[model samples]
Target: MGRNEFTVAFAGNPNVGKSTVFNNLTGLNQHTGNWSGKTVSNAFGCMSYKNITYTLVDLPGTYSLLSGSKEEAVARDYLCFQSPDMVVAVVDATCIERNLNLVLQILEITSRVIVCVNLLDEAQKKSISVDLKELSRRLGVPVVGSSARSGRGMSELKEMIYNMTVNERKTYVDKIIYSPEIEEEAEKIFEKIRQKCKSDRIARFLSLRLLENDEEFNKSLEKSIGISVEAGVHKKEYKDMIAEEIIKTAERIFLSAVSFKNSEYNKRDRKIDRILTSKSTGIPIMLLLFGVIFWITIVGANYPSQWLSSLFESVNQFVRDTLTNIGTDNMLVSVICDGILKTTFWVISVMLPPMAIFFPLFTILEDFGYLPRIAFNLDKYFKRSGTHGKQALTMCMGFGCNACGVTGCRIIDSPKERLIAIITNALVPCNGRFPSLITLISIFFSASLVFPFNSILSALLLLSVIVLSVFATLGLSKLLSSTVLKSERSSFTLELPPYRAPQIGRVIVHSVKDRIIFVLWRAVAVAVPAGLIIWLLANIYIGDSSLLNYFTSSIDGFARIFGLDGVILAAFILGFPANEIVMPIMIMAYTSNSSLMEYDSLTQLHALFTTNGWTVVTAICVLIFFLFHFPCSTTCITIYKETKSIKWTMLAFILPTILGLTACFLISNISRLIFMLAG
Candidate 1:
């Protein structure tokens, strides 16, 4: 421990609120980086406690320090090589025994540790009794129970860290001993590491990793020590057999040291799982949950959508009339009023309302811990598809943006599974597509002449499409794994976290900050340029017809087969930068006024579509095309980066295009034939 200043590292198992605790301790002062070229994100921050500054590094969350993956290797290397002044090993109090495995591993490396048993509030809520002092005595570490989210026990935790760092207090950790054969191998590796690295405090840890044949840690050590310890060990030839024995021995030691007892809550988990994960009930419940969320979003979004639409339309009318009353050229007036301003108006009006309602609701469910249960329920399907269970997490992220989904795939350990996840991520609908889907459903599928159920129908249909994509992804992944991208399914463990009461304030702010504002800004930015371009094409006459008219006529035949026109197709293409701009572009083209924004009702929208010769076939085709179509701009960039191959990126683009066009063509043909027969 250092006297006045100390380096404190926070380590924990995944999803134990370690990041939240770190953020609370350091506020917003944090720096992020990749640890030794691995994709896992790491962060370091500084916090002052009792007149002493502690530099705290937050390690990647993992189940154990076994170095089974790149992230585990990063955490293991930092703790071993850096040798922080004190290590705060945070464990979830509710799941103490499982989390203790990691703590035990950390203790083997350094005696300078304080076990922070967090989530005490959650534990108490579940009526689980934890004797903190007894646990502290048993583990031989200073135990502090905390709920970091509510700021409880944080001051005490800080005091404990400061005291340990400055030698004002001391703690011991229980020693774990393996069987004679395992102990002998560990001792042999420890001897080698001590001689090579000249540090006994960390040698045992290094020895165990070596025995496991951890590729990540071994590579890390090679960079640190300028030699491959594995190569040297194998150069002896007999060491390979010795290394195999070490892994077998370590696994026995690990299982012996950890005891998983079933509590009353565990029974409840079983009872809940019987229904939640049941073949008959799980799918229906999932469908119902999705439908309900969409219904809420649709109902809540309508008034705001109407308000925003009216507000934008009023501005558009005023600008157009005032400019026309002046001596300004109609072209100039149209460009200013319709092209630039109208596009901005429609983007804000159409996009903002739905996102404003939907994001918070989604966030609330996430915060309440429902999504994980959803994932847990679907894990079997994914496993059968030859991917890890946690690929479901990336799929959830896809709802926000597919690029983000692709980025989140780093959580999956297997290279082949992660690639498969990335390839199929675009199948999930992102927030940008929400407005277009909502508008289309409302306009085309009204059950009542007076009231619209479009948003409701749209949400359900979108959910169905998402479910269908899941199956499609699983089928493709299985095919790929068996044939071209053949690889074994990487073993994955998922934490089905206990459900909790969600914080409304946090949910709202997070939703607004992370989703609504970010997407709205993107929509407006893309909308302005798209608006101007649409206006130019609509107004610029080629001989007798406008440029937009010419384009529409040129693609008319092909569009008919696909149940779309050149104008709608072009709008969708332009909207690739941001899907929120599609409806605005469509309206602009249809009205021939760069700024017509008064489509406040689905009836008005339907009238507009009807006047333009839209059919049921067109609506069905549009829906199908939107479902299977091209990746957005951000997704394209992500594809390029992830594959680092232009070929895969082209495949991502072309595969969707072919599927979307074929699907739309088939749907249009069947729909037109049915209509003709019925008539």
Candidate 2:
């Protein structure tokens, strides 16, 4: 490393604007890469000032280092092991009392810390103020107050960072004093570990850890010291005393350094929470919000989707004509234009517009802190289903991508509950599946209605599907808890963060970069190959029929039992690579095309479906199956990667597919029975 280069570790409790501060400092120069030998990823960013380069590492948001959660362990290990030149403790000034817990804990490990009081604007809105000088004096570290969203106080924060790392100011960190008995016990082990640790604070921290009987910490201690050290068991009272004292110290410091102008400032938020979290209004309001989001997405995406479709088709024809004019083989022209371009653009046009509309709306809700209320509202259902309420958060993630939802299941502390969440996540339709669901709903369910009403009706139907998916998840979670994954329903505390106004510009930019582009690129990657495969299957003929037809005809009879013909089911099987290509595959097979084809609008798509004998029963069955079917290829692979067992992965695939098949069978047979009776 260069003399001017420094590594700074940024740490904080979740939702404290730590990432915002990092983003302000780093801008687009950031990378989310895993540290050596760690599962949880930490974000890294590089920035420069006055010819000196700083490497900022953003740690996972965790409340306490003592908490043995995998995520907290990563943060703790990095601060203890890596020995970064400086640490920045980002805290929410609006809730300084809660945030000080992590900051004080960091002080115990290292005194070289800058306590950044972020979200000062939010605090000011609430009529709260922090005495930064008093806080700095008490903590014996440099403290910077920053309102990162508006770039307020950011310059001071950067200058403080430069000063702390380069100038190396001396800090006398105030330690959390425990009871006499705990101190005496810690002293016995402190000298034993002190020589190796070389810092009094760290030695005392490790010494206290030895007394606490933390197995994870003990293992880590063994690694650092290169030998196992045994400790006598401490009484429960002593351990409790240490934890109690830490909080008491934080409270004392907060009381001395922070003040509120209006004590009832939060009264307004509490009143709003009453309705948002009320049992009766919560679910209804939640449904309405999602319904409106869907309505907007369905209505707003129309013009842009059509426009992109026309633009891509024009580009396709131009490319095709240019190739033909150059005497390029007709086969080559068809492969490039009709096969690859058609399916790829079909996915892009269909998938991009809805995502562009959906993710930003979702992100706004996320930034406004309403998402936790979603968990609060749905906690009872998940609790009844034998899982923690946090499953709701993961299920919400599934709406964007099931693969992401599966990865997010790590938040569930219980192994059994995490598995259940991962297995059931795909029940909720993701963005890739939304296009097919909306198209089918628009064509069959709401086509006869007028303009805005039709969009609203489609949204209601879509919301109904979402409701059913949630219930299905609950029911499946219950079944798994009762069956192979038997476990008691564990209760967890869901924190309802105070609501704040979202930063709209940051929300738009982050939603586009993080969600829209990532998903669109994935869809395109899978679509091109899917398009080529469709072409080969359609063009390769055996006897009088093409291979695609022969295969569909073979499965046609079996498919009839579920109210869907062969082409639809085959499309699903082929679309395993990505859900976005399913409709395109179906269109190609239905038309008996030698390559992929595009339907200009939902009207044209509806006509095509009708020509292929798609009845209401077919549409309903497809929609149900669409919701229940095996997850897209990405999600299944994520399931396997997480579970690390073929058995669990196979079960994940089978459970949803079985549900889809059973639901389709019941619906198709019941519809037929009613029709026969009426006739």
Which candidate has the top score in TM-score? 2
The whole-model lDDT of each prediction reads 0.72, 0.83
lDDT of 2 by residue, 211-272 (tens): 88777878987886653557534676766777778888889999999999999989988988
Candidate 1: regions farther than 4 A off: 1-10, 26-40, 43-60, 70-88, 108-114, 133-142, 158-204, 223-225, 229-263, 314-337, 447-459, 504-509, 528-560, 592-597, 676-679
lDDT of 1: 0.72
Model 2, poorest ten-residue lDDT window? 30-39
Q: With candidate 2 superimposed using the best TM-score fit, by how many Å does residue 500's alpha carbon deviate from the native? A: 0.3
Cα TM-score of candidate 2: 0.93
Task: Name the best candidate (by lDDT).
Answer: 2
- Give per-model TM-scores: 0.82, 0.93
Q: Mind giving the per-residue lDDT tens digits that candidate 1 earns over 426-545?
A: 767777777777777766764343434555666677676667767766776676667666797677767777656677886577566655567667756787788788889888997988
